[model samples]
Target chain A: MKLNSIHSITSSELNAFFEENRQRTLCYLESRFPVLQEDDIEDIFQDSSITLFLKIQNNELLDLTSSLYTFFLSICINIARNKVNRSHPTYLLSDNITDSDFEPIRNDKLEELENLVGYEIAEEQTDQEYLNWIEQQVREGVRQMKPPCNQILWSFYWDGLSHRTIADMFGMKSEDVSKTQANRCKHKFSDFIKKVIASYER
Target chain B: MKDNSIYNEQIDRFLKGQMSTEEEQQFKTEIGQNPELKQQVREHLYLIRGIKQVKSQEEQKIILQEQHEQKVTPLRRNWIKITSIAASITFIMVLSGIEGSRLYYRHEIRQYAYNASVGVMSDFAASSRGTIDEETKVHLTDLFTNAQEGKDLAETIDELSRLYVLTKDEFVDIEDDCAYQIGWFLAVSYINDGDYEKALEIINNIESEYPDNEDIKSIQKQLVEFLK
Candidate 1:
């Protein structure tokens, strides 16, 4: 049987289609961005899915010519780039490396055509929807925790706030944030996973 | 110092770049030498990264679509009443009930596709083994080659049923991948035999096993009416 293009799918059809492809999308995202933790990957996936769903609902798919996978890849890449930018001002001092030297995929000055094409194909295959779904689930799980847990998580990760700072913010003993966050989130996260697995098992 | 509250606080402080120089140095040392703490830091950092990239372009479209739906057919106008009524009846009678059943069955047909996927993987492994097993190869090739060549679909379908049973038994101990590989073959064979029901049964089983096989679902949906 031939697989049809995503364009022919109605909004409802697209929802079903995205749900089915979620796993493949997550696998592809994880493979592409090994730097991301599993939880982080899942949050990104949720965001992407919400975006895709909204886009379909609004009839905002402007360019019918672009493949769904390609459009999603561009979105995921941009999202990743945005995250990197938000996290830190600079990865490191440029030092000897000049601006022209960091040309992304082209940075490998001696790259062959086959390698380039292979990279493109790999990018094309990455499923942004699945990644977004997983990311959303993790975020939701985190949100259910206490404020201290939430603050510990966000401060440690997003804000890069020190444990002492988090403690000061909460008026708690500074060193307690890490232990508190981990202890609180782990069981809740496990229960969340159990729920997901149960849904799939059915 | 006795409480270790200062050190406990360092976990978040060092990770977020908010610790004092001495505290930061201590945290880095801990990170370098302590595996569990390092892993925790990595996971937390990853979560933050993921949360930051949640937005996508699809959202913009859905918002626009909502606006269009509201504006295109303004309320209190009753302008397209006749068309709307007819469409509504058609949708309820046909699309809602009957089509819903078709969708249910379509889900079932996906199983065949999953089985077919698994069969394909085994075939690959068998072929890649590089041993010259002519008789086995010929038999396997014939199974596919003759699966859909019959004039009478009923007879073909019966044969497909037997083939599915045999294939199912063979793959009992194997992974779902084998089912995926051989599901298409079974599906096609049943379609040829005029046993769309049996074909659909296999498809349904695979669909339950592998919900993501959209290509199989589409094909199964197309065949539902044809076979019936």
Candidate 2:
């Protein structure tokens, strides 16, 4: 459906759509970020939903596309990016980037549609054993990290906390919190890749 | 040039956008000069990208499922199928526990499998063994032991291990209880093989939820004595 047409759906109807997509979105957000918490995820989506709903009401949405999910994902991503930027995240190296001229490419490598279809196919390929193994590894990796680091990182990444708020939540200097987060999580990212490759090799 | 450790840390921070403006400039300049650093940065990006790809795929699947559900003809009997599946699983679990002899056999077989592979079976076999009920460890140890025997422990352990070795070099698939069980077995085997300190260390790290478990308590006691 077109953006204008979809935008006409009532707030209650929009909420129902959000609820329907919640589980799938949660799984996506968790894997993508891996450090966000449930509450944070709920909050981010709640805010996103409200923002989207208002946008539609005000005719701010330029286009809604074919489905509610597409529109919702766009809204969520925009909100997330805004939140990340506002946090003034302290990446150990963020301070080093005095060259404001350098901008990283922020292209989308994964699509919401492709993911859903792929998941249908992947569901058969991923047996319980594999899922169990990956989940266990993730849990163990999280366990090894310092409690605050693990908690805050998961809260932001998996659960969708803005970096600024995460800083406030942890009560650390935002920059230091971000640095600790990035440093602690770097190892997990490497380790996760190694494990996935190892599993595929096996 | 940055020290290897510093360079790695810098690379990590740069990739995560944690670097300061000055440091980020320096990092970028270093990358400009060094092909190796550039490659490391690329690899890091790829890892993050790959994870995002997986996440996106999962999200898409959920959306697809919802759409599919909407288009598909509604089946009034889905609950029946779900209930049947649930019943079957419950039945299998119950059946597994039935007949004292069968339960004993399952427990004994697991212990035997552990003994065969790891060279030491903890008090899982001994009647007088302490009350530490290490359930999680039991499951993992059983799977590893069974896998070692290959073909469900109805076959030779070495032969099974060899046939499966090509699939995954890793000796164990520690899913849920399986990991805890096998980890414990491996730790104990290390101890039995005269690596007391390593055994103590390994056991200490391989945690069980039930600290008060009889088997765990006994192991802790054993570890304390060994340390002494």
Candidate 3:
């Protein structure tokens, strides 16, 4: 395939180009999003190809300085990002947190953490076991957390939503407020885990 | 915590390729200095990659559907016209005491089976899985490509049948979609080769195993009618 503008390429050539890249693109997507269903992956590939074709037809590729595949990749990434954003809302603040609300961990909570780990301190546990314990504790704690706080952490950590987007979706006064609240919730969750460990040592 | 968020935001920008060259260099320096920040950046990158995969798959589906429609519609319309004309010609030939109408119908049926086989092969290629290694993947891809190109279909059918037999015991390890696809392709290949008995046998087996698989059931029905 000669490297040139999209305008010079025939439809058949365009289709051929897509056909050649189709399997490669699918493999790339599969490796990245192994969690996605096969049907969903196929859907994204088809959608991206069509978008690329349309862009080429409309002379949109003329402005693209990178190779055609790179442009196609960007389209795929943008679409995936948007889909994730829509499906997973990050800032569903059922409980809001503030810096002023901070409190020291209770003695009992630390004891609970120690008991859960089956050790005097977290360092006694294997790295994998320690991480798993923390994950389980965090999950349990988040469930009991106020709505927005759990939602904020879930969105930021799991869904990977940006603070600005979280703020807009959750009706926060500003991105700063969302960020601070998220930070507070994170600290609170960590504090719960620490308290549990601390009580074990005491 | 505030500084962490700032670092996270910078990591996000870096991953998204929104950062300038100088900013990206600075971000790299920060990551090198802070192990936690580097880990956070890696996690964010992984998440974004997954999202991209999902998005790309969706786009592929749209493109394939449009291509299928574009390819099938004209052929279907042309088939209708050709069939109508063939039917009229057959009527005239019958009236003229020509004994060739039977042969014509058989040829038409064979063509239909061939087209159906091609369709089944396409579906199989689209959903085929179960390759445990790169060599197996390459082999399967070659077989499918050859089959799709209408090259040595009998060999392709044998390869597919062998694969089915090899993987039959590991059904739990293989996805149902992939298993069904293999059976569908094998049955279709039999139909195309005019092995109605073999086709019916495979179809019946698939139907028994996957009663809810509409594609297999539909193929079984078509094979039954064709055999009749």
Best candidate, lDDT: 3
Q: Predicted candidate 1: what Cα RMSD to the true structure?
A: 22.7
Off by over 4 Å in 2: A1-105, A108-162, A169-173, A191-202, B1-29, B32-36, B69-228
Residue lDDT tens for model 1, A1-202: 1123333433444555456446645655564455667876676766676666555444455322233444554465556555545664464423332222111111121111112122111222223223223334554555555565555554444333334444544456544545566446644544554464345321
Better of 2 and 3 by TM-score: 3
Whole-model Cα lDDT of every candidate shown, in order: 0.42, 0.41, 0.48
Chain B TM-score of model 3, please? 0.45
lDDT (Cα, tens digit) per residue for candidate 2, span B91-113: 11112323332322222222222
lDDT by residue (B1-228, candidate 3, tens digit) is 337667655654554455788976776677567656654443333232222222222233333333333443322222222222112211111112222332223233333433333334344444443444557556765765443233456797888898778657764475555576577666655654556688789889888987864445555665565455
Better of 2 and 3 by lDDT: 3
Docking category for candidate 3? incorrect
Q: What is the lDDT, from 0 to 100, of the residue A27 in candidate 3?
A: 55
lDDT of 3 by residue, A49-145 (tens): 6677666444343233333455675576566555545655562422321211122222232222222222212324333223323333433455576
Q: Using TM-score as the measure, which candidate wins?
A: 3
For model 3 chain B, where is the 10-residue window of minimal lDDT?
B86-95
How high is each candidate's interface RMSD, in Å? 17.3, 16.8, 24.2
Q: What would the per-residue lDDT of candidate 2 be over residues A1-202, giving only the tens digit for each residue?
A: 3334433444334546566556645554444433456666666677776666555444333222222354575566556545555553542223232222122222221121122122111224433234323433443444455555554444443333345444544455764566567555665555664666466532
Q: Estimate each model's TM-score.
A: 0.23, 0.29, 0.30
User: What is the two-chain DockQ of model 2?
Assistant: 0.05
